[model samples]
Target: MGAFDMLSIAGSSMGMHQTWLDSLANNIANVNTVVSTSQTAFQTQTPIVRALAGGGVEVAGLALSDPNGRLVSDPGNPMADADGYVRAPEDDLATQMTSLVMAQRGFQASVQVTKDAQDTYRSALEIGRR
Candidate 1:
Protein backbone atom coordinates (compact mmCIF):
# COMPACT_ATOMS: atom_id res chain seq x y z
CA MET A 1 0.00 0.00 0.00
CA GLY A 2 0.99 3.61 -0.51
CA ALA A 3 1.92 6.06 2.22
CA PHE A 4 -1.49 7.68 2.03
CA ASP A 5 -3.11 4.27 2.45
CA MET A 6 -0.95 3.57 5.48
CA LEU A 7 -1.96 6.87 7.02
CA SER A 8 -5.61 6.13 6.40
CA ILE A 9 -5.31 2.74 8.05
CA ALA A 10 -3.57 4.19 11.06
CA GLY A 11 -6.07 7.00 11.34
CA SER A 12 -8.96 4.56 11.23
CA SER A 13 -7.32 2.46 13.91
CA MET A 14 -6.87 5.51 16.12
CA GLY A 15 -10.52 6.42 15.79
CA MET A 16 -11.60 2.88 16.57
CA HIS A 17 -9.41 2.81 19.65
CA GLN A 18 -10.84 6.13 20.77
CA THR A 19 -14.34 4.72 20.50
CA TRP A 20 -13.27 1.67 22.50
CA LEU A 21 -11.79 3.89 25.18
CA ASP A 22 -14.96 5.90 25.41
CA SER A 23 -17.08 2.78 25.81
CA LEU A 24 -14.75 1.41 28.47
CA ALA A 25 -14.94 4.67 30.33
CA ASN A 26 -18.71 4.55 30.26
CA ASN A 27 -18.68 1.03 31.56
CA ILE A 28 -16.36 1.97 34.39
CA ALA A 29 -18.42 5.00 35.27
CA ASN A 30 -21.52 2.87 35.63
CA VAL A 31 -19.86 -0.01 37.43
CA ASN A 32 -21.52 0.82 40.70
CA THR A 33 -24.93 1.51 39.22
CA VAL A 34 -27.68 -0.29 41.07
CA VAL A 35 -31.27 -1.05 40.12
CA SER A 36 -34.17 -3.03 41.46
CA THR A 37 -34.06 -6.73 40.85
CA SER A 38 -37.16 -6.51 38.68
CA GLN A 39 -35.43 -4.10 36.29
CA THR A 40 -32.45 -4.67 34.03
CA ALA A 41 -29.07 -3.57 35.33
CA PHE A 42 -26.54 -1.45 33.49
CA GLN A 43 -24.93 -3.56 30.82
CA THR A 44 -21.29 -3.18 29.86
CA GLN A 45 -20.77 -1.97 26.30
CA THR A 46 -18.09 -3.31 23.98
CA PRO A 47 -17.10 -1.89 20.63
CA ILE A 48 -17.25 -4.12 17.63
CA VAL A 49 -14.37 -3.53 15.25
CA ARG A 50 -14.12 -4.88 11.76
CA ALA A 51 -11.28 -4.96 9.22
CA LEU A 52 -12.15 -3.34 5.95
CA ALA A 53 -11.16 -4.92 2.69
CA GLY A 54 -9.62 -1.58 1.65
CA GLY A 55 -7.07 -1.77 4.46
CA GLY A 56 -8.76 0.24 7.16
CA VAL A 57 -10.67 -0.42 10.36
CA GLU A 58 -14.33 0.34 11.06
CA VAL A 59 -16.53 0.29 14.15
CA ALA A 60 -19.34 -2.06 13.27
CA GLY A 61 -21.49 -1.63 16.37
CA LEU A 62 -21.60 -2.10 20.10
CA ALA A 63 -22.15 -5.35 21.92
CA LEU A 64 -23.93 -5.16 25.24
CA SER A 65 -23.37 -7.64 28.03
CA ASP A 66 -26.22 -9.73 29.39
CA PRO A 67 -28.36 -8.14 32.07
CA ASN A 68 -27.18 -10.57 34.68
CA GLY A 69 -25.99 -8.19 37.33
CA ARG A 70 -24.79 -9.14 40.78
CA LEU A 71 -27.32 -9.33 43.57
CA VAL A 72 -26.28 -7.51 46.72
CA SER A 73 -28.15 -7.48 49.97
CA ASP A 74 -28.65 -4.02 51.43
CA PRO A 75 -31.69 -3.69 53.57
CA GLY A 76 -31.15 -0.01 54.28
CA ASN A 77 -31.05 1.01 50.63
CA PRO A 78 -34.26 2.52 49.24
CA MET A 79 -34.00 0.69 45.90
CA ALA A 80 -33.58 -2.71 47.44
CA ASP A 81 -36.02 -5.46 46.51
CA ALA A 82 -38.37 -7.35 48.82
CA ASP A 83 -35.44 -9.55 49.87
CA GLY A 84 -33.31 -6.46 50.55
CA TYR A 85 -31.27 -7.24 47.45
CA VAL A 86 -30.31 -4.85 44.66
CA ARG A 87 -28.86 -5.64 41.27
CA ALA A 88 -25.47 -4.08 40.59
CA PRO A 89 -23.82 -3.81 37.22
CA GLU A 90 -21.59 -6.75 36.38
CA ASP A 91 -18.79 -4.57 35.10
CA ASP A 92 -15.39 -5.57 36.45
CA LEU A 93 -13.13 -2.64 37.27
CA ALA A 94 -9.90 -4.58 36.81
CA THR A 95 -10.90 -5.89 33.41
CA GLN A 96 -12.03 -2.44 32.32
CA MET A 97 -8.74 -0.93 33.50
CA THR A 98 -6.75 -3.49 31.55
CA SER A 99 -8.82 -2.84 28.44
CA LEU A 100 -8.32 0.88 28.84
CA VAL A 101 -4.56 0.39 28.96
CA MET A 102 -4.65 -1.73 25.82
CA ALA A 103 -6.76 0.84 23.99
CA GLN A 104 -4.37 3.61 25.01
CA ARG A 105 -1.42 1.63 23.68
CA GLY A 106 -3.21 0.97 20.42
CA PHE A 107 -4.05 4.65 19.99
CA GLN A 108 -0.43 5.61 20.69
CA ALA A 109 0.83 3.08 18.17
CA SER A 110 -1.52 4.41 15.50
CA VAL A 111 -0.40 7.98 16.19
CA GLN A 112 3.22 6.89 15.77
CA VAL A 113 2.37 5.21 12.49
CA THR A 114 0.68 8.38 11.25
CA LYS A 115 3.72 10.45 12.26
CA ASP A 116 6.11 8.08 10.52
CA ALA A 117 4.04 8.17 7.34
CA GLN A 118 4.04 11.96 7.37
CA ASP A 119 7.80 12.01 7.88
CA THR A 120 8.34 9.62 4.98
CA TYR A 121 6.20 11.77 2.72
CA ARG A 122 8.10 14.88 3.74
CA SER A 123 11.42 13.19 3.03
CA ALA A 124 10.25 12.14 -0.42
CA LEU A 125 9.20 15.72 -1.20
CA GLU A 126 12.57 17.04 -0.01
CA ILE A 127 14.35 14.55 -2.29
CA GLY A 128 12.26 15.73 -5.25
CA ARG A 129 13.17 19.36 -4.43
CA ARG A 130 16.88 18.57 -4.50
Candidate 2:
Protein backbone atom coordinates (compact mmCIF):
# COMPACT_ATOMS: atom_id res chain seq x y z
CA MET A 1 0.00 0.00 0.00
CA GLY A 2 1.06 3.57 -0.61
CA ALA A 3 2.03 5.84 2.28
CA PHE A 4 -1.15 7.91 1.77
CA ASP A 5 -3.24 4.78 2.20
CA MET A 6 -2.51 5.04 5.91
CA LEU A 7 -4.37 8.35 5.94
CA SER A 8 -7.39 6.81 4.24
CA ILE A 9 -7.41 3.92 6.68
CA ALA A 10 -7.10 6.22 9.66
CA GLY A 11 -9.87 8.43 8.33
CA SER A 12 -12.20 5.47 7.90
CA SER A 13 -11.39 4.22 11.39
CA MET A 14 -12.10 7.65 12.79
CA GLY A 15 -15.44 7.76 11.03
CA MET A 16 -16.44 4.35 12.34
CA HIS A 17 -15.38 5.30 15.85
CA GLN A 18 -17.36 8.52 15.61
CA THR A 19 -20.48 6.60 14.68
CA TRP A 20 -19.94 4.27 17.62
CA LEU A 21 -19.53 7.25 19.92
CA ASP A 22 -22.77 8.72 18.62
CA SER A 23 -24.65 5.48 19.32
CA LEU A 24 -23.18 5.27 22.80
CA ALA A 25 -24.20 8.86 23.45
CA ASN A 26 -27.74 8.14 22.37
CA ASN A 27 -27.91 5.10 24.61
CA ILE A 28 -26.58 7.09 27.56
CA ALA A 29 -28.96 9.95 26.93
CA ASN A 30 -31.96 7.62 27.01
CA VAL A 31 -30.78 5.64 29.98
CA ASN A 32 -33.40 7.24 32.22
CA THR A 33 -36.16 7.43 29.65
CA VAL A 34 -39.40 5.94 30.90
CA VAL A 35 -42.46 5.07 28.89
CA SER A 36 -45.99 4.09 29.61
CA THR A 37 -46.87 0.40 29.55
CA SER A 38 -48.69 0.96 26.30
CA GLN A 39 -45.50 2.10 24.59
CA THR A 40 -42.23 0.34 24.03
CA ALA A 41 -39.31 1.53 26.14
CA PHE A 42 -36.28 3.14 24.58
CA GLN A 43 -33.80 0.69 23.18
CA THR A 44 -30.05 1.04 23.44
CA GLN A 45 -28.36 1.75 20.10
CA THR A 46 -25.23 -0.14 19.14
CA PRO A 47 -23.20 0.40 15.98
CA ILE A 48 -22.25 -2.64 13.97
CA VAL A 49 -18.80 -2.22 12.43
CA ARG A 50 -17.11 -4.28 9.77
CA ALA A 51 -13.60 -4.40 8.39
CA LEU A 52 -12.92 -3.82 4.71
CA ALA A 53 -10.96 -6.38 2.77
CA GLY A 54 -8.63 -3.75 1.39
CA GLY A 55 -8.20 -1.77 4.62
CA GLY A 56 -9.89 0.29 7.35
CA VAL A 57 -13.38 -0.18 8.83
CA GLU A 58 -16.99 0.83 8.29
CA VAL A 59 -20.25 0.98 10.23
CA ALA A 60 -22.38 -1.80 8.78
CA GLY A 61 -25.57 -1.12 10.69
CA LEU A 62 -27.08 -0.42 14.08
CA ALA A 63 -28.27 -3.10 16.51
CA LEU A 64 -30.67 -2.29 19.27
CA SER A 65 -31.08 -3.71 22.72
CA ASP A 66 -34.09 -5.79 23.68
CA PRO A 67 -37.41 -3.99 23.44
CA ASN A 68 -38.88 -5.81 26.40
CA GLY A 69 -37.94 -3.48 29.20
CA ARG A 70 -38.26 -3.90 32.91
CA LEU A 71 -41.29 -2.52 34.65
CA VAL A 72 -40.95 0.05 37.40
CA SER A 73 -43.54 1.17 39.87
CA ASP A 74 -43.88 4.94 39.59
CA PRO A 75 -47.39 5.90 40.46
CA GLY A 76 -46.33 9.54 40.59
CA ASN A 77 -45.26 9.52 36.94
CA PRO A 78 -47.86 10.98 34.62
CA MET A 79 -47.22 8.26 32.03
CA ALA A 80 -47.46 5.43 34.50
CA ASP A 81 -50.02 2.71 33.89
CA ALA A 82 -53.13 2.21 35.98
CA ASP A 83 -51.14 -0.12 38.18
CA GLY A 84 -48.40 2.50 38.70
CA TYR A 85 -46.06 0.66 36.38
CA VAL A 86 -43.74 2.25 33.83
CA ARG A 87 -41.38 0.62 31.39
CA ALA A 88 -37.71 1.46 31.50
CA PRO A 89 -34.95 0.17 29.28
CA GLU A 90 -32.84 -2.66 30.69
CA ASP A 91 -29.64 -1.07 29.48
CA ASP A 92 -26.84 -0.95 32.06
CA LEU A 93 -25.16 2.40 32.66
CA ALA A 94 -21.86 0.75 33.53
CA THR A 95 -21.75 -1.08 30.25
CA GLN A 96 -22.59 2.05 28.28
CA MET A 97 -19.94 4.11 30.06
CA THR A 98 -17.34 1.45 29.42
CA SER A 99 -18.19 1.42 25.74
CA LEU A 100 -18.01 5.20 25.61
CA VAL A 101 -14.52 5.17 27.07
CA MET A 102 -13.30 2.54 24.65
CA ALA A 103 -14.78 4.32 21.65
CA GLN A 104 -13.20 7.63 22.69
CA ARG A 105 -9.81 5.95 22.96
CA GLY A 106 -10.20 4.38 19.56
CA PHE A 107 -11.14 7.72 18.01
CA GLN A 108 -8.21 9.44 19.65
CA ALA A 109 -5.86 6.73 18.47
CA SER A 110 -7.10 7.08 14.92
CA VAL A 111 -6.55 10.84 15.04
CA GLN A 112 -3.03 10.25 16.27
CA VAL A 113 -2.42 7.81 13.46
CA THR A 114 -3.56 10.43 10.95
CA LYS A 115 -1.22 13.01 12.42
CA ASP A 116 1.70 10.60 12.43
CA ALA A 117 1.07 9.62 8.86
CA GLN A 118 0.98 13.27 7.79
CA ASP A 119 4.20 13.98 9.67
CA THR A 120 5.90 11.02 8.05
CA TYR A 121 4.79 12.09 4.60
CA ARG A 122 5.99 15.66 5.24
CA SER A 123 9.39 14.42 6.46
CA ALA A 124 9.78 12.33 3.35
CA LEU A 125 9.09 15.39 1.20
CA GLU A 126 11.73 17.36 3.11
CA ILE A 127 14.25 14.58 2.58
CA GLY A 128 13.54 14.59 -1.15
CA ARG A 129 14.02 18.35 -1.32
CA ARG A 130 17.37 18.15 0.53
Candidate 3:
Protein backbone atom coordinates (compact mmCIF):
# COMPACT_ATOMS: atom_id res chain seq x y z
CA MET A 1 0.00 0.00 0.00
CA GLY A 2 1.03 3.58 -0.57
CA ALA A 3 1.78 6.17 2.10
CA PHE A 4 -1.65 7.69 1.49
CA ASP A 5 -3.32 4.32 2.16
CA MET A 6 -1.42 3.97 5.44
CA LEU A 7 -2.72 7.38 6.44
CA SER A 8 -6.29 6.35 5.64
CA ILE A 9 -6.00 3.22 7.77
CA ALA A 10 -4.64 5.15 10.74
CA GLY A 11 -7.32 7.82 10.41
CA SER A 12 -10.05 5.19 10.42
CA SER A 13 -8.55 3.45 13.44
CA MET A 14 -8.46 6.76 15.33
CA GLY A 15 -12.12 7.45 14.57
CA MET A 16 -13.22 4.02 15.75
CA HIS A 17 -11.10 4.31 18.89
CA GLN A 18 -12.76 7.64 19.69
CA THR A 19 -16.15 5.98 19.57
CA TRP A 20 -14.93 3.13 21.74
CA LEU A 21 -13.71 5.59 24.38
CA ASP A 22 -17.02 7.44 24.31
CA SER A 23 -19.01 4.28 24.88
CA LEU A 24 -16.84 3.26 27.82
CA ALA A 25 -17.16 6.71 29.37
CA ASN A 26 -20.94 6.65 29.04
CA ASN A 27 -21.18 3.16 30.53
CA ILE A 28 -19.10 4.18 33.56
CA ALA A 29 -21.15 7.33 34.07
CA ASN A 30 -24.44 5.41 34.22
CA VAL A 31 -23.26 2.72 36.58
CA ASN A 32 -25.13 4.20 39.55
CA THR A 33 -28.51 4.80 37.89
CA VAL A 34 -31.42 2.98 39.50
CA VAL A 35 -34.43 1.65 37.71
CA SER A 36 -37.82 0.44 38.86
CA THR A 37 -37.18 -2.98 37.37
CA SER A 38 -34.43 -5.02 35.80
CA GLN A 39 -36.09 -4.90 32.42
CA THR A 40 -35.98 -1.14 32.32
CA ALA A 41 -32.60 -0.54 33.88
CA PHE A 42 -30.03 1.39 31.88
CA GLN A 43 -27.65 -0.85 29.93
CA THR A 44 -23.98 -0.33 29.17
CA GLN A 45 -22.91 0.09 25.56
CA THR A 46 -19.95 -1.01 23.44
CA PRO A 47 -18.88 -0.13 19.94
CA ILE A 48 -18.46 -2.75 17.21
CA VAL A 49 -15.85 -1.92 14.62
CA ARG A 50 -14.83 -3.60 11.37
CA ALA A 51 -12.15 -2.71 8.88
CA LEU A 52 -12.91 -2.01 5.25
CA ALA A 53 -11.21 -4.22 2.74
CA GLY A 54 -9.84 -1.35 0.63
CA GLY A 55 -9.75 1.65 3.01
CA GLY A 56 -11.82 3.82 5.46
CA VAL A 57 -13.98 2.97 8.47
CA GLU A 58 -17.18 1.02 9.17
CA VAL A 59 -19.09 0.57 12.42
CA ALA A 60 -20.51 -2.94 12.71
CA GLY A 61 -22.92 -2.13 15.54
CA LEU A 62 -23.43 -0.99 19.13
CA ALA A 63 -23.56 -3.78 21.67
CA LEU A 64 -25.95 -3.20 24.56
CA SER A 65 -25.37 -4.05 28.22
CA ASP A 66 -26.49 -7.27 29.83
CA PRO A 67 -30.25 -7.59 30.40
CA ASN A 68 -30.02 -8.74 34.01
CA GLY A 69 -29.56 -5.84 36.39
CA ARG A 70 -27.87 -5.94 39.75
CA LEU A 71 -30.18 -5.95 42.73
CA VAL A 72 -29.39 -4.02 45.87
CA SER A 73 -31.43 -4.28 49.05
CA ASP A 74 -31.95 -0.94 50.80
CA PRO A 75 -35.27 -0.46 52.53
CA GLY A 76 -34.76 3.28 52.91
CA ASN A 77 -34.20 3.83 49.22
CA PRO A 78 -37.29 5.35 47.61
CA MET A 79 -36.79 3.44 44.38
CA ALA A 80 -36.76 0.16 46.22
CA ASP A 81 -39.70 -2.13 45.64
CA ALA A 82 -41.85 -3.81 48.28
CA ASP A 83 -38.96 -6.18 49.01
CA GLY A 84 -36.51 -3.27 49.40
CA TYR A 85 -34.82 -4.36 46.19
CA VAL A 86 -33.68 -1.84 43.58
CA ARG A 87 -32.46 -2.58 40.08
CA ALA A 88 -29.27 -1.12 38.69
CA PRO A 89 -27.04 -1.89 35.77
CA GLU A 90 -24.73 -4.82 36.49
CA ASP A 91 -21.89 -3.03 34.76
CA ASP A 92 -18.73 -2.81 36.87
CA LEU A 93 -17.00 0.57 37.03
CA ALA A 94 -13.62 -1.06 37.29
CA THR A 95 -14.21 -3.08 34.14
CA GLN A 96 -15.27 0.00 32.28
CA MET A 97 -12.25 1.89 33.49
CA THR A 98 -10.00 -0.88 32.30
CA SER A 99 -11.65 -0.83 28.91
CA LEU A 100 -11.10 2.92 28.75
CA VAL A 101 -7.42 2.45 29.41
CA MET A 102 -7.17 -0.13 26.64
CA ALA A 103 -8.97 2.15 24.24
CA GLN A 104 -6.65 5.03 25.10
CA ARG A 105 -3.65 2.87 24.43
CA GLY A 106 -5.04 1.78 21.07
CA PHE A 107 -5.69 5.40 20.16
CA GLN A 108 -2.13 6.35 21.05
CA ALA A 109 -0.78 3.51 18.95
CA SER A 110 -2.80 4.62 15.94
CA VAL A 111 -1.59 8.21 16.35
CA GLN A 112 2.00 7.05 16.48
CA VAL A 113 1.55 5.00 13.32
CA THR A 114 0.10 7.99 11.51
CA LYS A 115 2.90 10.27 12.65
CA ASP A 116 5.55 7.78 11.68
CA ALA A 117 4.00 7.25 8.26
CA GLN A 118 3.89 11.01 7.72
CA ASP A 119 7.55 11.34 8.65
CA THR A 120 8.55 8.55 6.32
CA TYR A 121 6.71 10.22 3.44
CA ARG A 122 8.30 13.58 4.24
CA SER A 123 11.76 12.04 4.29
CA ALA A 124 11.08 10.43 0.93
CA LEU A 125 10.68 13.93 -0.52
CA GLU A 126 14.35 14.66 0.36
CA ILE A 127 15.34 12.47 -2.61
CA GLY A 128 14.54 15.47 -4.90
CA ARG A 129 16.93 17.75 -2.96
CA ARG A 130 19.84 15.26 -3.10
lDDT by candidate, in order shown:
0.92, 0.93, 0.85
lDDT of 2 by residue, 1-130 (tens): 9778999999999999999999999899999999999998899988888999989999999998878788999999999989999999888789899999999999999999999998999999999999
Q: Encode model 1's per-residue lDDT on 1-130: one tens digit a residue.
A: 8659989999899999999999999999998899989989899999999999999899999999889788889888899988899988886889899999999999999999999999999999999999
Query: Which stretches in model 3 have alpha-carbon errors above 4 Å?
Result: 55-57
The residue ranges of model 1 lying beyond 4 angstroms of the native Cα positions read: none
Ranking by TM-score: 1, 2, 3
Report backbone clashes per prediction.
0, 0, 0
lDDT of 3 by residue, 5-93 (tens): 98999899999999999888889889888866534777888888877989867678898877667887877888888898888887888
lDDT of 2 at 53: 91
Give me the runs in candidate 2 sitting further than 4 Å from their true place.
Answer: none
Output the better candidate (1/3) by lDDT: 1
Reference-based TM-score, model 2: 0.91
lDDT of 1: 0.92
Candidate 2 achieves a global lDDT of: 0.93
**TM-score of candidate 1 on Cα atoms, chains taken together:** 0.94
Q: Candidate 1: worst 10 consecutive residues by lDDT?
A: 87-96
